[model samples]
Target: MPSTVPDSLDGWWCDSSTEYAFVGFSYEVTACQSRSTLNSEFKDIRETFDGRYVRLYGACDRTGFYDDVIDAAWNNGLGVHALIWFGFEGGSEWKDRRDNLIDTLWNNPKAKFVTRAVQFGSEPLYDYVLDPSDLAGNIWEFKWNIEDLGIPVTISELAYGYQVRGGAQIVLDSIDVLDAHILPYFSQTASTGDAAWKDVNNDLNWFIDHAAGRKIWFSQNGWPSTHYSGVEPNSPDAVADVDNEERYYKLLESKCEFFKSVAGGGVGWFWHIYADWQEPGYGLYAESGKTKFDFKPRTEC
Candidate 1:
C-alpha cells in the first residue's frame, strides 16, 4: 500500500459473479519486516483500490518466517489467499513445517476465508526430475497434506503456461487443483513447450476441460524489467527483446489482459507494488520510489 499504485482496475469486476471471475494481487511475505511495514505497503495499495480482492501469499523461500509474515499480514487486515509453500519440497521439513504453518493459518477464522495453495516444489516439474512415480507420489503426498490441513492445494510451476495442456491433466488427475506459473522472461522458451500467448490459452482451455469439477489458477505470471543476463537495458532499436525492461512491461500488460479475461477462473499476479529484493530492477516500484510500471496493480488489493 505504499504510494506506488495505479488508479485503474478498481471495481472492474463488481458486477461479476461467476466461477471464472478472478482479480487479486500477490505479495512476497518476507519482503519487509514488522507489521507496520507490511501494513503501510498494503495500505498504500488498497487506498486507491476497490472491489478486487487481495491474495497475500507467504513467499515460501523463507519458510522459516512464514508464520511471522502471515501473522503480520493478517493483523494488518490484508486478506491472504493461497498460503504458498514458497520452496517446500518432498523432503524439506515436509511434515513439521508444513503442518505447523497450516495449523497457524487455519486456526484463524479469517484465514479460512483466504484461498490456500500448497506448492510442492518451485517449478517442481522443471527444476527437479521426478518420474511418473515420484511425481505422482509427491503430488499425492502434498494432496493428502492439503486435505488433512483442510485447505485447497495447487501445484505452482513456471512452464505450466505452455505445458498445462498435457501436464495439467496429469496433475489435475493427481491433485485437487493446478497452479500454473508464467514468467515473462522464461515463458517463451522451449521449456514452456510453446511460447505463444495463444498457446498458453489453449493450455488453459485444456485444463478447463480436464479439470473435472476441480479448479485451476494461473498462480504466478509477471514480467521483469530486464531479461536474463540483464541484457538490452539500453538497446537502441525498438525491437522486442526479452532483455529489455521496457519490453517486459509491454509484454506484461498484454499478458495481464489475457489473464484478466479468465478472471472467473482465479488468476493472481505474482508481485504487488515492488521493492528491492536483494536484486536490481525487479520490484514493480524501484527502491528509488519511482514506480516501474505506471499501471502496476496492487496485489495487496
Candidate 2:
C-alpha cells in the first residue's frame, strides 16, 4: 500500500455537487449483501444523495468480513470511514479485535487507499467498554500501528461522553477529529416536539463550543421514521413520526451551508442509517426500497 493518500481529508470534507449539506451516512455492511448489491448501494448513495462519504460499521461481520465494501466505495468515488466496533462488550477481546483489523489493513492495500480515516472504535466509551484513558490508549495504539498509512484517527462518541466525570480529557485529547453521534431523540429536548430542528442546532452549537479547537464531524445524526405508541417505553413526544422526520430535514435545509462551513463547525456530517431493510427504522429508504419522505439530494439513502 502507498504510504500517502492522494486526496486526504487535509482540510475538511466538502461536496459542492450535493444540494444537501450532509456529506455521508452510517452504513453497516453484511455478508448477505453481494458485490453487486454493495456496488448498487454505493452508486445509489453517490448518484441519489450526491454523498461523498460513508461511516461503515459491521466490517467484522459474523459470517466473514467483506473487502468489497472498500472496493465499491472507491469505485463510486466515496470515501469510507472505516471502524472497529467495540459494541458494549467490556472485555480484553476489544484489543485483539483492533489488532486483527490492523493486520487485515496491512494485507488489504485497497483499504488504506480508500480510507477517509481509521476510527478506533465507535462509542466504546459511551458503551462503558472502556473508560476515557483506556479508550485513549487504544486510539493511540491504532494511530501508531497505522502511522505509515497517513490517515487521521478518531473514535465515535456521544457529546456527553466527553463530559463524563468532569470531561474525559485523556480521550478527548487523543483524536485527530472529534467524531460525534449527536441525536436529539435521545436527549430531553426531544420532548419539545415540533422544535426538534432547533434542538439539533442547539446541540450542534454545544459541540462547536466544546470542541477544544479540534475539528468536529458528526458521524451519526438522524430521527427514527417509525411513530411511537403507549406500549413503547419512550414518552409520547419522544418517538419521531414521518411528519417530524420531514420537518427536521426541511428545517435543516437552510442551515446546511453553515454546517458544512469550517468556520461554522469544522467538518461535514452523516445521516445515521442507509436502509430500513438493513437495520430497521432511521433509514431514508424504506423496506421496499422506496423513500420514506420528500428529502432532496436524497429521497432515499
Candidate 3:
C-alpha cells in the first residue's frame, strides 16, 4: 500500500438504476428511469457539483450497463472506484460474475484511464453476507488477479465492524486501501448535525488506530434531506432537509480537513450519492435534477 493519500475529498457514489431500472438485490432498491435521464443526471453532477471521481457498485453484467456508466464517468472527466458485488449464497455464480466484470473493465480502454481502484465488495461483513476470513480470502484472490493492473484493491466495511467483529483485522491487512462507511444516523444512539460529527470523529479515530498507516477512505457518507416513513425509526430526525443537509456537508468538510491535517493527507471522503433514487434525501441533487443546496467544502475552520 502506498503511504501517500489524496489531498482532497471530491468523490461520489453513482449507480445505473436511475436509467436502467435495475434491481439492486443487496438493498432491494430499484430506479426506474430512462438512459437519457441518467446521462443528464451525470452531466449535472459533473458540471454543477464539481465531482472529480465516482464510486460504482457491482460488476458489468451481460447487458454492459456498467460499461456505459464507466463511459459516462470518463467522458465527463470523473475517475471511478469500481466495485464488484459478491452474494454469499451463490459462490460459483458470484465468482463468474466477478470475473466477467473484471474482464470487461480490463479490456475497456476507457477503464484504463478512469479506474482509480477496484473494490472487492461493499459492506459484506457488516451485512453478515460473508465472514471476515472468507471475505479476506476472496479479496486476496481478487487482489492477486488485479495486481498486474497496478490499481489498488479494497473492501468497504462499516467503520465499527473491525473493532466489533473478530476477523476484520485479517481483511484489513489484505487490502491496499481501507474503505469504511461512516453513517452516524445508523448509530445505536441517535444523533444529528454537529452531534453526529462527534460520532464520525470517533469512528475515524477507530479506523486510524487499526488501519496500520494505510490510507483511509470513506466509501459512503451523507445525510438524507427528507424523512422517509418507517425507515430509520429510531433516528427519525437524523434525516435532514435542504438546510440541515448543508450544515452536515459543511461539518463533513471541516472534519475531513482536520483528518487531513492529522493524517497528513492520507484520507479521502466520497459522498453517498450524486442524486436521490429509491432512497430519498441522500442525493445532492433532487429527483427533478435540481441542485439541493450549495455544497462547498471548507478548507479551513
The digit string of per-residue lDDT tens for model 3 on 1-301 reads: 1133233323322321111111011111134234565466556556665555566644444456556666666666666677777654546555776787678666775564567677777777766667788878888888777666667788877876666677478888888877778777766664565568777878888888877767677777767677776656356456457776677777776554365554423556777766665357777668896768876543223
Q: Point out the higher-scoring one by lDDT: 1 or 3.
A: 3
Alpha carbon deviation, residue 63, candidate 3 (Å): 2.3
Winning candidate number (lDDT): 2
Residue-by-residue lDDT tens digits, candidate 2, 194-295:
466666776667667767666667787777767544323244567566666666666556566565564433456787789877666678888888988866
Q: The CA-based lDDT of model 3 is what? A: 0.63
For model 1, the run of ten residues with the poorest summed lDDT: 12-21
Task: Tell me the TM-score of each prediction against the true structure.
Answer: 0.64, 0.84, 0.79
Clashing residue pairs in candidate 3, if any?
A: 224-281, 225-240, 225-281
Residues 77-133, model 1: lDDT tens digits: 454444434353355554455566566554644344333445554456555445544
Which parts of model 3 have CA positions greater than 4 angstroms off? Answer: 1-39, 58-62, 87-93, 233-239, 298-301
lDDT of each: 0.47, 0.69, 0.63
lDDT score, candidate 2 = 0.69
Candidate 1 lDDT score at position 209: 57
Worst 10 residues of 2 by lDDT: 11-20
- The alpha-carbon lDDT assigned to residue 27 of candidate 3 equals 15
Order of models, best lDDT first: 2, 3, 1
